[model samples]
Target: MKISCSISFEQGLGERLMFFKRRIEKKTYDKSSKKPVIKSSICNGEQVAGFKDIATGAFEEIMLIKNQDDLVEFKEIYGISEEIEKIY
Candidate 1:
C-alpha cells in the first residue's frame, strides 16, 4: 500500500501561517527614549508605524499601516496604549 499527501498553497493558508509567525515573534524598544509614532509620506500618503527617538528625532520602521487591523497588531505587539503621533 502507498499513500501520498499534497498541500496546496493557493488557499489562504499562507496568510494564516504568516499571521501565526507574526503573533509568535515579539519585539521591544526603549520606552524611556522611544515613543510610538506613525510616519506618513507627504507625496504618496504612505504610513509606517514605528518608534521614534525622543532626543534624536530618529524613527525606526516596524510595520506598514495598511488598515486598522495592522495598526491594532502593531499596538498589541509593542504594548502601546497611548495615542500615537503622526509625522509627515
Candidate 2:
C-alpha cells in the first residue's frame, strides 16, 4: 500500500533531524555542515522511499490520494491531531 505523511520544521536540517528522532523514536545526527548532507527518509513496513519539502527547513510527506475525500479520511484514520495549515 502506498502511504504519505507530511512533516514541518521550524529550523534547518539539523533541527529537523532532531524532531524526527523524537517523533519516530529513532537515532539521528547533526551532519548539516557537510556538503551534500543526507536528509530524512520516508519508509513503510517494507522500505524507504521519498519525502516532501515544506519550507526552508520544514518538510511533509507526499502521497497519492484516490480523491479529495481520501485525504480527509487519511487524516482521520491516522488521528493527526495537529492543525495542518495546507498550502495549495
Candidate 3:
C-alpha cells in the first residue's frame, strides 16, 4: 500500500514563489530632512503612514495603516525606532 500527500509539487512551488514575491526589501529615507508621521483623517478616521518634510511641511505617503501589523511593517521597512507624530 502507498500513501500520497494532497498538495502537488506545482502547488508547493507556487507557494514558495509567492513567499519570495511578497518578501519586503529594506528601504531608507532622509533622516535629516524628513520624519515619520501618521496622517489621520478628521472625519473618516483613515490613517496613512509616511514621512513628512520637516521644513516645508510636505507629506509623502508610503502605505495605508489599516491595522497594527501594517504600521509595524512600515516602521520595520524604514528602520524607524522613534515615536511617530500624528497630524490631522
Q: Is candidate 1 or candidate 3 better by lDDT?
A: 3
- For model 2, residues 1-88, the per-residue Cα lDDT tens digits are 9999977665765554234522322222223421111123344222111132323544334344555554554445444434444332
- Judge candidate 2 against the unseen true structure and give its global Cα lDDT, from 0 to 1: 0.37
Please list all clashing residue pairs in model 2, or write none if there are none. 5-61, 6-60, 6-61, 7-59, 7-60, 9-58
Highest-scoring model, TM-score? 3
lDDT of 3 by residue, 1-88 (tens): 9998653245554642232335678899999999999999999999999989999999999999999979888988999888789999
Q: Which residue runs does candidate 1 get wrong by more than 4 Å?
A: 1-24
Model 3 vs truth, CA RMSD:
7.8
Instruction: Give the Å error, residue 68, model 3.
Output: 0.2
Error of 2 at 3 (Å): 34
How many clashes does the backbone of model 1 have?
A: 0
TM for candidate 3 is 0.74
- Specify the poorest-scoring 10-residue window by lDDT in model 3: 12-21
